[model samples]
Each structure stands twice: as C-alpha cells, then as structure tokens.
Target: MSHAPTHVTCSDVSFEWPDGTPVLDGFHWAVGPGRTGLIGLNGCGKSTLLKLVAGELRPTTGQISVAGSIGYLPQDVTLATGARVDEVLGIRATRAALHAIEAGEATEANFAALGDDWDVEERALATLDQLGLAGIDLDRTVGELSGGEGVLLRLAALLLARPDVLLLDEPTNNLDLRARRRLYAAVASWTGVMVLVSHDRELLDRVDQIADLRDGEVRWYGGNFADYEDMLAGEQEAAERMVRVAEGDVQRQKRELAEAQVKLARRKRYGQKMYENKREPKIVMGARKRAAQESAGKHRIMHAEKLTEARERLDQAVEAVRDDAEIRIDLPATQVPPGRRVLTATDLRLAHGAAVAGVWEVRGPERIALVGGNGSGKTTLLRTIAGLVPPTSGEALTHVPTRYLPQRLDVLDDESTVAENVARFAPHATNNVIRARLAHFLFRGARADRAAGTLSGGERFRAALAALLLAEPAPQLLMLDEPTNNLDLASVRQLTDALESYEGALLVASHDVPFLESIGITRWLLLDGELRSTTAEEVRESRWED
Candidate 1:
C-alpha cells in the first residue's frame, strides 16, 4: 500500500535532566514514511526520544524537526472520568453545530463549525467500530468504559484527527489479548508514518522496520523484529570471529617482539666479545655498534606499534558483541513437592460478581494464567487471592507462603535503598547475603545503595522482583499481576530466566501471551465475573466484548 511521506528528524539532539542526569547526548535519529519500531533495553531513552519528537519535551542542546502534523499517544493516558466521549473525541462543538442546523436555528458561527462534512458522527462510529469499539455510545462518560477501552478511545480520538505522523508509546500495555489483536490490526492498517515504542513482541513484528536506539544512537535494520534479530545474530557471530582473530594477532605480535629482543641481545654479546678480542679496527667496531643499536630501536618500535593496533582492533571487536546479563537466582527453597496443595478457593465470590461454580485448587508446581478483559476483575481477583482484600462472599486460602507483585511495582519502600528493601523482606538474612542475591538481579555495589524512588523504571523493577522473590521463608506460591508491563524485551527475558529457576506453584495475571508461554503455564483460567478453565489455544481465540 502506498503512503504519504512524512519525516521526523532529530539532529545532534541532547537532553539532560535538571540534576545533570544525561539521557541523550548528540543523538541523531530519523524516520520517514512506514511503521518504525523504536526499540531498546529499558532506560535506553526510547520514550524520552518520542516525547521530544512530540514536542512534549525539548532537547537541551540540539533540534528536532518534523515535516507534518503529529498525533501522540503517551504511555499513561489520563482522562477526566466525568468527561463525555464526544468531548474526549474533540467533536462536541461540531456535534452542537450539526444539532443547531437540524433545528433550523443555523447561524454563521454554527455553519463555520459544521463546515462541509455532514457525516462526522457516522465517520466517528465507523472509526470506533474499526478499533473493536462498536456500539459504544458516543455520549457515555469516560468512567463507564474499561481501562483498555479508555486507551482505545484515546486512540480513536487521534484517528479522527488524521494526522500525518503517529506516535504510540506502550500502546498495548494495558490491553488484554483480544484488545491487543484489535490494536495490532489498527497498526497494521496504518498507511502513514508511525513511530511505535513498545516491548510487545507481537506488536513489534508488525512494523515495517526496526530502529534500535542505544547509547544515544540508532542502528537501523530492515524489516520487522524477527528480521532484526536474525541480522543482529549474524553481526554478533562475525564480531566474535573477529575477536578471536585479533587475539591471535596480538599473541603473535608479542611473540615476534620477544624473539627480536632475544636476537638483539645475542648480537650485543658477540659485538662485545669481538671488541675485547680486537677482531677489527676500533672505528669499524664503533660504526657496527651504532648500526646495531639503531636497528634494535627501529625493530622495537615497529613491534610495539603492531601490538597496539592489534589490541585496538580487539577492543572494537569486543564492543560489537553484546553481553546482556541474565538474571540467575537460586530458589531451591521455593520448591513444592508433587501432589502438595499450594492454594485453594472455596465458593469464591469476587467483589465484582457472584460466587464461582466450584472449589478451585492448585497443587504441586502448577503454573496458571489468569486472564480476561479490562474491568473483568483480573487484578482484583489476584489481590483477593493474595489476602490483600477480602472476598465478597467466600474465601481464598494458600497453604504455602505467597508473594504478589502488582502492576504498580509498589513492593519497594521509596525512602529505602534497594538493599534495604530486600532486607525488609528477608529480615533474618545478613546484609552480605542480601547484597549477594541483589547482584544476581544486576544490582551490584553502589547500585544496591540507591533509593528505590530514585531508580529508573527498569532498575526499580529489578529491585522489586529481588525483594519479593528473596523474601524470608521463600514464597512457595507466587502470584504476579501484569508483571511485564514496564519491562523492555531484554528484561522480560531475564524475568523468564528468574522464573524458570522457581520451583513453586505460580499464578500470573498478565496480558503478555508470549511471556506467559515462555514461563510454561500449566493451566489457563478466564476470569470474567467468574473463573473457568481454559486452554492456551482458546485464550488466544477468545473475545470478551466490553
């Protein structure tokens, strides 16, 4: 499909916080027509770059230029719950004008507002339906919609504007599987310039190309996320090969230099012996001595230069290879014996609805996926199961110790350091033990001393996960709610690694299907007013209309 050409250019842009925390320095990135997935590790300035382009934040040192109109959807969209859908869609005045004209009270002001388009409402409804929001009352208040619906509503507003450029930051973070598929369709149908920032693998796979932003620079790769991975793998393989070659060259240079020094020493001894025996005239002997010394100096300099060049090549080769640190924590204490009952729910009636059909039980190390539409009580159900809130009618119980990591990541104390937070969970463990375990989470030394409130989103996630998993007595039944929301793709992998080592019954409430699959969920349950058994296949195909 052909698309209108739009350009977003960042030239020598640099931005730093007021406290002198550097984010981007001399960063240069550019994107034109077609969807571009802006990706990198967490804390790599992906969102900051998008904000700068959207004019929400200004570059400290350089300039950003865009050649077309822009529509920006931020990560956390805040809307007034009391506002009407028409008001949020920015069509209230236009609707009012249409009404006045129909009432035979059309004035010049009303005509100006109405313009030439008489099918605006019809078009709005079509747009809503295209985004899987069909039949939604345009006059309904924002509070009536679910969280996922609210996000889509905001997107619908942007679609109505029909801007030349679109930027969406973590657009699918709050969306469930069905909602995500609808969003994916919308993105796929976009025929204009789009800069999408997200860690959602399925979403990234739809982009035309991938622009990896790292160390304040962008490395472009043609095609989608899978293509980018293939190209990167090839590059890494070549880099490792070059590193081996450089190492061999360095060793060879060192050996050659040593051999040259040994030969020079032997010549010096022979010359001294010849001088003592008066084998030649004194002038000839002095001439031979000067030539020998000059030759030795030149040889030494040449070998030194060769060695330096080899080492430099090695350094460059090493930098080309990525050494992503994986999270590895031993959780032997969390192990559960087969047939051991980990948790049970008896006639559980969530605060949102009626009592469930039967007694729910999780035994052994069963990993369960709790999923449903927004406002379907996924988070609320998990919270109730964790004992944070009481059920409306029945009870939920856990025989083993449990830990719940909420979507907000509120496990850490804002005032305390990362180490202190972990220590809070493991009160009986020594400082040395806590710090050592934090290192596995990539929080080492002074990093462990940083206050939880001061950490970046990624750092804060690591700190919270460490604290929860390493808590005293080791939680044998772990429950997580939207655990991968704030993480980057790499961090998600690390999370998978950490969970792989866990040997307990796990109940995760998340919309990330790939991550759910990666962690090896043994069961799936859909919680829409009531929880029911489901399969991974059914979960992917199931649709829950808001």
Candidate 2:
C-alpha cells in the first residue's frame, strides 16, 4: 500500500514531570507514512510521547513538528453529557449551515461555514457506520451511549476530520469483540502517518512497523508485533551467549592472575634463600632482588587491569539481556475439591433486565469465560455472582468463598499503602509475610510501601490482585471482569503467570480471547439476555449486530 506524504518528527525532545522525574531525554524520532506501533512496558512514556506529538503536552526542551494536520484519540475518552453526537463529531455547525442553505435562507455566513463540506452529514454518517456506530443517532445525546460506543464515537469524529497524521493510545481497551473487529478494519485501512500506543496484540499486528520505547530511547523494528517478538527473541539469545562467554573469560583471567602471583612468590622465596646461603656478594644479591620486585609489580598491575576489563565486559553483557520480571506465587489454600460445587444460580434476573432463566452450577476447578458485547450484562452478571448485586428473582449462591475483581478496580483504597491494602484483606498476616508474598507479585522493598494512589496502571492492577488473592480465608472462587483492560503486554503475561498458580475455579468476563485461552478456560458462556454454552471458535466467528 502506498502511504501519503506526511511527517511526525520529534527533535531532541526531553520531558519531565513536576517532581523532576525524567521520562524522555534527548529523544529523537521521525516517522513518515505507514502505521507505527509504539510499545513499551507500563510507565515507559509511550503515551506521553504521543501526547507531545499531538500538542496535548509540551516538551520540557526541544520541539515537536508535524508536517500536516493531526488527530489524536487518548486512552481515556469522555464526552460532555449534554453534547449531541454530531457536535461530538465536530460537524454540527456545517450540517446546520447546509440545512439552512437548502431552506432558501442561504446567507453568506452559511456558505462560508459549509466551505467545501456540503456533504458533511453524509460523510459523518458513513464514518460512523464504518466504525460500527451506524445505529447511533447523530442527534442522540452522548450520555445515552455505552463506554465502548463512546470510544468509537470519538474515533469516528477523528476520522471525519481526515487528518494526515493520526495517533491512538490504547484505543481497544474498552471495546468488545465486535467493536474490536471494526477498529481492526479501520486500522488496516489507514494510509497516513499513524502512530499507536497499545498492548492489544491484534491491533499491533496490523501496524506496518514497531517502535520500542525503553529507558528514554526509541528503537525501530521493521515489521509488526509478531516480527518484533521474533527479532527480540533472537537478540536476547545472542546476548545470553555473549554473557556466558564473558563470564568464562573473567574466570580464566582470574585463574591466570592467581598463577602469576604464586610464581612470583616462589621466585622471591628462592632469591631470599640464596641470599641467606651467601651464594653471591651482598650488593649484587640486593640489586637482583630489587629488579625482581619491580618485574613482579609490573606483572601484577597488568593482570589486575586485564581482570578489571573482563569484569566490565561481563557487566555490559548482562545489561544487554532483558530482565523483565514475571509473577510467581503458590496458592495451595485456594484449591477446591473435584466434586465441590463452587457456585449455583437458579432462574436469576438481574437489575439490568438480563435473565438467567435456568439453574446453572459451577463445579470443581472449572474455568469459565463470559463473552458478550457492551451492555450485554457481563459485568452485571459477575457482580450478581459476587453478591454485590441482589437478583430481582431466583437465587444466586456460592458454596465456597468468592472474590471479585471489578472492572474499575475499586477494591483498593487509594489513601493506603500497598502493604496496608493487602493487610486490610489479610489482617492476620504479619508485615514480613505480606511483603514476602507481594514480592512474588512484583512488589518488593520500597514498592510495597508506596501509596496505592501513586501507582501506575500496571502497578495498581498488581496491587489489587495481591490484595484479593492474599485475602483471609483464601477465596476458592475467583471472578474477574475485563481484567486485561489497560494492562501492558508484559503485565498481561505476568497476570497469566499468577493465574497459572491459582488452584481455584475462575469465572472471568473478558473480550481478550488470547488471554482467556492462555489461562486455560474450560468452558465458554455467551451472555445476551441469557447465559448459553458456546465454544471459543464460535465466539471468534460470531458478530453482534443491533
């Protein structure tokens, strides 16, 4: 595909927060044409860089330049409550002007406002339809839309602008499967200078290239996310080999130095013995001893320098190998017996009007995936199972202890420290015990002391997970809603690893199919007006239409 001629450039950019913590330092990046996936671990400033390029943020030093107009969709998008859809799309004024002109009240101001956009209303509707918002009325209030639909509406607005450069940050975080497909199609069709910061594997796969941001520097890769992973694996393997070689060289140098010292000591002893035996004149013996001492000093210095160089090489080689941490913990207490019933719901009807008209039971350590579109009552159903919401009819019961990790992660207290939050759940655990277990969740030392309000997105998620999993009585049934919503790829992997150690039944509601498959989901249930048995293949192929 031929891309348009447009450039997004950053020259010697440096950014820092008010606390003097630096994010980007002397960063230089220039992207043109094709889509570029900007990726890094959480809190690595990928989103900050995009904000700078979009003019939402200013660089502490240097400048950002765009050769053409730009459009940016932020990670969290919220519209005004009273704003109409067309107003959100930024075409309301033009649409109104066109209507006025058609009504024979063609004023000079109306023509000026219309400009070349006489067909603005048609184009706006078309863009909305393309983004899976065809059923959305342009005159409808923004408050009437679901969260996922709101995100799409904002993207549709950006599309209506037809900017040469487009930036998206975690655009698919709230989207369901069908909405995600629409987004994927839109991304695949982009033919401009586009930069995206997302952990969505499918979305990253559609990009033309990948730009990795680490340690305040950007490294370019030639292809999409999968290609980037392959390249990274090869680099890590080579780095590991280099580390091994350097370690061996260091050991050999140390051994050679030790042998040299021993030989020097032996020579000194022989020289002293000869002098004591009066084998030569005293003055000649003393001169010979002085020369030997000088030679020994030179040899020692040379060996020491070589050892230092070798050790430095080893350190550099180790640094080249990435040390991304993984979560590893044992949850033996959460195990459930094979014949035990974990949860049961009978003819339940939720406050949201979604019905579970038949008796359903979750037994043993089954992993259930709840799949559905936005507003299809996935979260409500999870809440209903968690006992947070009472069913309007029938009964929902859990025989085992249950824990729910909500979509908003409101279980954590912002004012409390991470350790304090965990302590709230596991009051009987000692401080040392809690910290020891939190280390497995990647919170160690000072990290555990940090306040919950100050954590990054990934850190906050980890803190919440730690608090929930380490709670008193040990929850035998764990339920999570959209657990991977804003997590980075590394955090997502860590989450998978954490869940691998969990021995309890899992009832998770999410649109992340890959994540669901990774954790070994044993059953799939589709939630529309009722929960029904389904398969992963069917879920992947199905589309929800209004």
Candidate 3:
C-alpha cells in the first residue's frame, strides 16, 4: 500500500463557505499512491478537503490536480428513493444497451453505449457482493434498502466506475459489523490512490499513512492510525518536557530581573550618599554617578528583554502541547439500584409487524448492546421502547425515568444556546449547576451561549447528548441509537468517558463493537424479526444474524 507514487496535488488551496466561514486557507496537500486516512476534529476540513480533491467543490483560490480518473463517495449519500439498485449503481444504461444488443435490435448508439463494457452487470453485482450488498436485487428500490445498504451501494457504484483515484468520506458510518468487515476488506485490497476520511479506528488502522487535517493544514504521519497515535504520544511527552524546562527558564529570568532591580536601587542610594557626603572631587563624583546610571539602565533593559524572551519561549512551548480534554460526568440523579426494574416489554412487535418478538426487558443498570444486521429494525425497536412510537401489538413500559437520543439528534432546539438547551432538559437545576455540568463536556463560558444551530457536527452531538442525559427527574434508562454516527475520535472518546460515569441502564443500538465493549456491555442481544440473547463473541462472529 505504501509503494505508490503521488497522484494528486493541491497548490495553495483555500476554501470557505458562502457565508465566509473559512475552512481551509492556503492548504497544500499531495496525495501519493496508496491508502491515506484523512482525520481531524469534526469541524476541520477533512470532508471539505476530500471534496476539493475529488473536484466536487472547487477551491476558493489556487488549484488542484489529479493525474487520472476519480471516483468519490460523499459522507451523506442521498439516494433517489424510487431509483432502482442498478440505476444507483450507474450501470442501468450499460445493462439496457447490452440487453438491446441481445434482443437482435442492436442500434449504432446501443452498440456504442455497450462498447468494451459488455460485462458491466456482472461486474456491478460482483462489486456489490464485495461490499456485502449481494442480497439486494437490481430491481429493488433505494427506499427498500437500509441506511447501511445505501452507503454500500454508493460505494459499489464507485468501485464499478474503476477510477484511478478514490475518495471516500466516512464510508463506514452506517455499516453493520458484517458490512464493516466487507468494507474493510475492500479498503485493504485497494492499491490505487485512495484518500479516506473517517473516524472509524479500525478502518484507519488499515491505511498506509495518516493525513491529519487540522487548522487547514495537513500533517503527514508515515503509518496507520495506531502509528500516528504512538508518534503523537511521544511528541506530546517531549513537548510537555520542553514546557517544563521553558517554565523554569521564565521563572529564573523573572528572579534575575527582580534581583537586578534591587541592585540598581541600592546603587542609586549609594550614588546619592556619595554625592551628599562629597566623598570625592565634584567631577569624579559626577562622572561616577553618570557611569553607574548608564550601567544600571543597560542592566535593567537586558534583564527585561531576557524575561520577555523567556516568556515568549514558554508560550511557544506550551502551544506544542495539545489539549485533549475528556468529558467528566457525575450525575448522581441518574443512578439506579442494582435490583430495580428499569424497563419491561411483553410480546413486543413493531408497528410495521417486523420481527420484534417476545419479552424485552432491562433490569437495573445493565449496559446492553442491541446488535443486528442492517434494516433489522433496531432503531424502531429502540424508539418503541422509548415510547416515541407505539408497538404494533405489545407494550413497552419503563419502570424508571427514561430518555432517548435518536440518530437524527433532533432533541436539541437549534435556535437555542447550549445553555438554553441544557436548561430545557434540566429546568429544575440552577443555571450555575447546569453550566458547571456543561463545563465537563468542554463547553465553557461564552461557548455555552453559542446557538446550537451554529455548532459543528461534534459540538451538536455533544449538546444533544448532554441534553438527553441531563433531562429533568434524572433518567434511569438511557437509549441511544447510532450515537457515534458523526462523532470524531475525540468526541467518541468523550462519549465513552461520559458513559463510564453513567450509572443508568443503557441500551445502545450501534454497530460499533469496540465502543460497546469499551462501555462495559453486560449483555448482547441480537434483533431480527425476533429478539434473543447472544454473547459478544457470537454477536461478532455471526454479524448479529439469527
């Protein structure tokens, strides 16, 4: 993967939104042959850089060049609901042309359309299968497929295009475990110039190198995500040591400056005494006074300059240390007793009559991982349990106070500030208390006053998560569906840290097994047309299949 040559170049590129929000400024990046993982914080230009490289969005200034054909898969793929699978795969025309030629009515245009690509249908189906999209028939509409399947279908289209350069943005965002494996395999097999932007740690670990896009510049780490982390850890440790050394220098300079001032004061006093006592000739005394004064002034200036330089060095050294703050949540109200009944469901069935069968229950603070394949109604089940919708023929009852954070994250009122949103959730709590809790989530002071709508993806997720968890009356049962969908690595870590502090029952429906494990999942349940208990190992091995 690391053996390929450079295939892309961006020279002095700059981009910003129409509202003049700057994303990139004079950014220059070169895409070499091999897989490169582009990663950064949520608001950073990872996605935007991918777009610029793919020519989907032109740079506001400068130029970008790609050596060959490009195939791009965007983060948020919007498929035409009525469009057929084959149509979305971009082979409908070729298929139709091939069929026409087979029907003995081969027109010139039909033959031209099918030129050299007679096996397009076979290739399309093969690519779809490669991405774990085999069961989906060509006639099936986009609306029929699950969210994960739709993403895979888009990827299949890109693969079918067979471009020299491939750009994928969060390709594994909605994929199930099995689907993720398939995608990972595809990524590993990719040998061309591939620039992938994702927060999926597993996917990033497969890259040849890491392209960290932060503050509009790309820093290359010559290895996968794990290598980048190791290198960064070393760099941070060294930076911290430098900061300590710099701090000592600043303090020493300050002390020397203070001592110099004392000496100058004493000299001034001695000079006054010499003049008052008339200890020498008037000219000699006057000359000595002037010389002493000049020396004192020079000494003061030199000491002051030294202190300023030391402080400046200290500031630069401090800047080298990255601030990777983790969320610290302590909600005593969310705690539940070990023997308490948190949730109970009897003869559970979905509104669509999909397979949600038998008793579904959560006792005490059980952290359950609701695992299943794509389109298995996990979201619907979670929503049903949360009382967002009524079950078709069963009842889901929460014995304890409950809250749900849906995938759409519409819980936050966009017009309100973060503080206002939290206030809405925790109305009984005082503003000071609410803000104090928010500070743990890294929203401090004026940041708490920013409107939710203006927040970046990670910030919005944090706000929504904060609001859901901090709801009034203290939720004892928390349901989250695809909570890690758009979170960056830091946000994901913060979410994990916050979950560690949660004492409530958790039912998180996510394909993120590593994340689920990190949060200490006590039980794993596979959801299909029916629900049944499963072990973590089985859940992983079978892809949550029955």
TM-score of each: 0.95, 0.97, 0.95
Q: RMSD in angstroms, all models?
A: 2.2, 1.8, 2.2
Please identify which of the two predictions, 1 or 3, would achieve the higher lDDT against the true structure: 1
**Best model per TM-score:** 2
Tell me model 1's lDDT, rounded to 2 decimals. 0.90
Tell me the tens digit of each residue's lDDT in model 2 across 1-546: 124468988999999999998999999999999999999889999999999999988999988999889999999998998999999999899989999999998899999999999788889899999998999988999999999999999999998898899999999998989999999999999888899998899899999999998888888999999999999999999999999999999999999999999999999999999999999999999999999999999999999999999999999999999878999899999999887999999999998989887899999999999999889998988898888898899889999989999989999999999999999999999999999999999899999999999998899999999999999989999999999988989999999999999999999999988889899999999998888988999778654333
lDDT of 3 at 433: 92
What lDDT does the true structure give each of the candidates? Answer: 0.90, 0.92, 0.88
Which model, 2 or 3, shows the larger lDDT? Answer: 2
Distance from true position, residue 507, model 3, in Å?
A: 1.3
After superposition, candidate 3 runs with Cα above 4 Å error: 1-6, 354-358
lDDT of 2 at 118: 78
Tens digits of per-residue lDDT for model 1, 346-419: 99888877356579899999999998877788888888888898888888889999999998999889999999
| Model 3, span 321-394: residue lDDT tens | 87768898888888998978898888888876666556666888999999888878898888888888888787
C-alpha lDDT of candidate 3 relative to the true structure: 0.88
Best-first order by lDDT: 2, 1, 3
Decoy 1 TM-score against native: 0.95
Off by over 4 Å in 1: 1-4, 268-286, 544-546
